[model samples]
Target chain A: MDFNPIWLTLKLACITTLLLLVIGLPVAWWLSKGRSFFKIIIEAIVTMPLVLPPSVLGFYLLLAFSPQHGAGKWLQQTFNIQFVFSFQGLVLASVIYSMPFMLGPIKSALQQLPVSLSQASYSLGKSRWQTFIRVLLPNIKPSLLTAAVLTFAHTLGEFGVVLMIGGNIPNVTRVASIAVYDAVEQMDYHAANVYSFILFAITFVLVTGVFIFNKYQLKSPLE
Target chain B: MISINIEKKIKTYQGQRILKVSGEFKSESITKIHGPSGAGKSTFLKVIAGFIQPEQGNITVNNNAWLDTVSKISLSPQKRMAGFVFQDYALFPNMTVKEHLEYATADNEWIKHLLEIGKLETLTTHKPQYLSGGQQQRLAILRALATKPQVLLMDEPFSALDPENKLALITELKLIFQELKTTVFIVSHNPQELDGIAADGAILSELYINN
Candidate 1:
């Protein structure tokens, strides 16, 4: 009956989802606008987490952030932050884990915009950044919503990355997925069911909302 | 005063070539760049607007380097003040007409005057996606005109309208420019050529666009 792990998972999912949105939007915007070579490379990198088994990405992240790497030593020295098996480590894992979920919709929405819209803004003497903020961002409202929600739900379902990075230390690192595995290992079906049901509900609602929105709300402004 | 000089511009896409115009466009006149489909008409416009770079050439507007292959002086569209009206009426779908008009700081006493001139006083809040072809055409014209650019560029602006509406839009555009005295550049394939021929107030800068 370790409820701490379940609570920790929810907290991690929310925080990781927020960070992913912040990080993913810029990546998506760059990918959407840049030349094919850069766009292709970044897009490939973002989907790498989804392509490989989660355990692979998790193991790689652990190596990247371990004391053996200069980055790991610098982080520790500068901020006293250790990410080998911490909540921050889980967030890093989740950002890679759910990048595609956030980036795909944003890229699609950006592509749907008319080239003239940006041209019109620019021709009126607005900078590229200003045009992006005032003209481009407002037009892709549906994509932004889609990216945020999908990333949130996708991070909730993350297991292998958290398992590798978080190390299942209850209240500190252990999360719902890890808790469910623990319950199953202990033959405690009831505890596992609680975490599993909530996870399922969250994903179901998130995806269903996307379908409804796409069906009724996204009648593309560029006709 | 606006002036554009282009030298030996060439562009090729997937082994297909279009647009080979070598001439100068002066200000205070509506120079219609006429040509058939795949004529590189739009491509030429884009090259001057800073959206596309010519394979080998230099373009200067008012002695300012808009594009130069020699010293590589290429300016962005925002810096050029070359207004464009897209063929498909490229309006911002997210914004209402009022927002679009206000966004560009094109709001002035002159706009109220052009509103009367262009006859666009009523459709102030509508978006292009919601408007009909003719309505969108009119809106595109107004949007470009709103900026009061030294050189206003249009790609097949009146293609979407019937004869009467096209004539009406063209006549109104001529009258407005007669008052404003701004330079204009337009592209027309055929059928649309008839309207360009009728802009009597605008001095012709360069000739030979296809029908």
Candidate 2:
């Protein structure tokens, strides 16, 4: 019933989705268009979280975020930044955990598009950036919508990584999923039911919306 | 004049074959590249357009070196500004007929003129899906011409047109080419398809590639 966790979770999801889009768009574009052995390696790394256990990813992130270690120590010494048990830590972890959800659909959509579309744009005197924005982006709306929704929902439901990297801190690290877990741990069946129902309903709606959109895309002659 | 001397190795199902070509196309003339399937006609066009990199090549358009392997100077496609009508039409599915032209240039008068020439005035608001194959082909041609490019590359441009439409469109295209002084290179499997246009002030240059 606490509102702080809900607001924090929403904030985290929003930030994570935005960051993933900024980071994932180029990655997806490369994965779709590039032809190199390194391309396969990069793709494998991106998709690792999808198959690897969430706890394993969380444990690694937790170690990397610790101030005594490589990346964390460098970040702290250079920029006075702290990751473990912080809002930034949760965002970083969520972005990594939800990357495949954001990238997979987008890459598949771009791959499905005929390479001629981009070639046409280029021959029409548009730069690669211009073509990507004005032409390629508009044609893949359904996939982009699916990516955004899935990323947002996945970040919202993230538990293992969030718990490992960001130990529960009121109004900071605590999110809706963590709140539900805490409610059950305290034997508060009523609170757990309330949080669980809310999460379940929201996720169901988002996933259903994506499926309906995917169907519409299939029926679309333009695709 | 566009002078091209390029060598590219192509990997086919059978084996690797080198695509070696060297030619000079005059300004404001139409050059037809006739070849069998898998002759790398499309790949040749792409190399000129800066899409595909040839292992060893140099393409000089209007005295500007678009691609020079020795100096490692390869201008990107946007800088080349070569209008291309792909074999598959390559029309943007999301863009309407009018939007396609609008995306290329901001000149309303030019677009109006192009719409009239392509006979797509009524279908300006229609997307590629709503149009027939011939209409789509015409749209692709119009979209390519929208840029008023100095060099135009077309790959099997008239494949979908009916005989009557083909003749009429070819006549109109000849006048446009003459007026604009545009250099054109068209690839075709059927050599006689562009005869009408060639006879009408389109100086014919042939480059044959055997599969």
Candidate 3:
């Protein structure tokens, strides 16, 4: 019956999706350009989360941000910020776990756009940045929406990474997925069902919205 | 004057081919570039517009070095400021006919003039998808001219227009080009497409590229 986990999950998903959108756009744009070995390697690394087990990523993150050694130690000492078992840790993990969802659609859409669009913009004395913001991004609005919704839904469903890095702190790190696990462990089936159904309903709505919006966009004259 | 001597390697269905073009185009003149399919006619326009970088080349526009591979001084496409009307139109699906011209220039009078010249003033609020093929083609040309560029590169610009429309548009364009003093490089498969414009005493130099 406690709603703290649901609120925390929503907060985490919102923050993670926002951060990834800001970071993913430029990265996706860079990766969409013509291929090179260096770009291929970077793309592979960004795409690793989709295929790699969430627990594996969580385990590495745990080690790296343990505050006892390595990056965690430096971060804690220099910035007085702790990433392990904290809300910040959950946000960071969700961003990493759901990156492919945010980037895949965007990168493919950008690549699919006719190259002449940018060239036409450039010939008008528009700078590369201007062309990207004014021309390229406007044409890919549907893809952008799809990417954001998918990332949010994926982050909402994240259980393994959240459990591994963000232990079960009440309001700080206990998102809905982890809360469901905790409820089941304590033999509270009713609480577990409530959390499970809510997560399922939200994700279903988000994914269905994306499909409906995309279909309408296809019929609309203005892309 | 614009002098270009460039060699670019391009990929065709047959395989790799080198496109070498050397020409000196007079200012305020119209040059018709005719070539066979896959002969790099479009590629040559892109190179001049600075969208494609040739392996070795030098392009000097009015005695200013736009490109010099030896000195590694190649201006970016923004610096070139050459207006281009893509073969496919390349109109922004999100923009209306008026918005396309407005994006290229801030002068309202110039935009109004371009719309009238293209005969697209009545369809200014329509997007590319709403416009017919010929209308879209005219919009592309109008958008390019909105910038009032010193040079304009057009590829198969009149392929969609009917004979009457083509003739009317060409007649208006001839006067506009002279008024603006814009050097034009038009690529067309049909040799007689712009004959009327060429016959009107504009310097109608011809360049051919064969594979």
Here the TM-score of candidate 3's chain B is: 0.98
Writing each residue's lDDT as its tens digit, candidate 3 over A1-223 gives: 8999999999999999999999999999999999999999999999999999999999999999999999999999999989899999999899999999999999999999999999999989998899999999999999999999999999999999988999999989999999999999999999999999999999999999999999999885645
Q: Which scores higher on DockQ, 1 or 3? A: 3
Docking class of 3: medium
Query: Which structure is stronger by lDDT: 1 or 3?
Result: 3
Ranking of all candidate structures by their lDDT, best first: 3, 2, 1
What are the DockQ scores of the candidates, in order? 0.58, 0.67, 0.76
The sequence of per-residue lDDT tens digits that candidate 3 reaches over residues B28-89 is 99999998999999999999999999999999988989899999989988888898999999
Give the interface-residue alpha carbon RMSD of model 2. Answer: 2.1
Encode model 1's per-residue lDDT on A1-223: one tens digit a residue. 5678767877877887788878877788888885788678878888888789999988888888886667888898889888888888988888889889888998888877877778878887889888888889988887788888888888878889888877888788888888888889999999889989877887898889988886666566554
Model 2, stretches more than 4 Å misplaced? A68-70, A73-80, A221-223
Candidate 2 per-residue lDDT, tens place, B1-211, comes to: 9899999999877799999999888999899999888989999989988889999989998899999999999999888988999988888988999999999999999999999989999999999999999999999999999999999999999999999999989998998888888999999989899889777556888999776
lDDT of each: 0.76, 0.91, 0.93
Against the true structure, what is model 3's DockQ? Answer: 0.76
lDDT at A140 for candidate 1?
A: 88
Note the residue pairs that clash in candidate 1: B34-B209, B34-B210, B35-B210
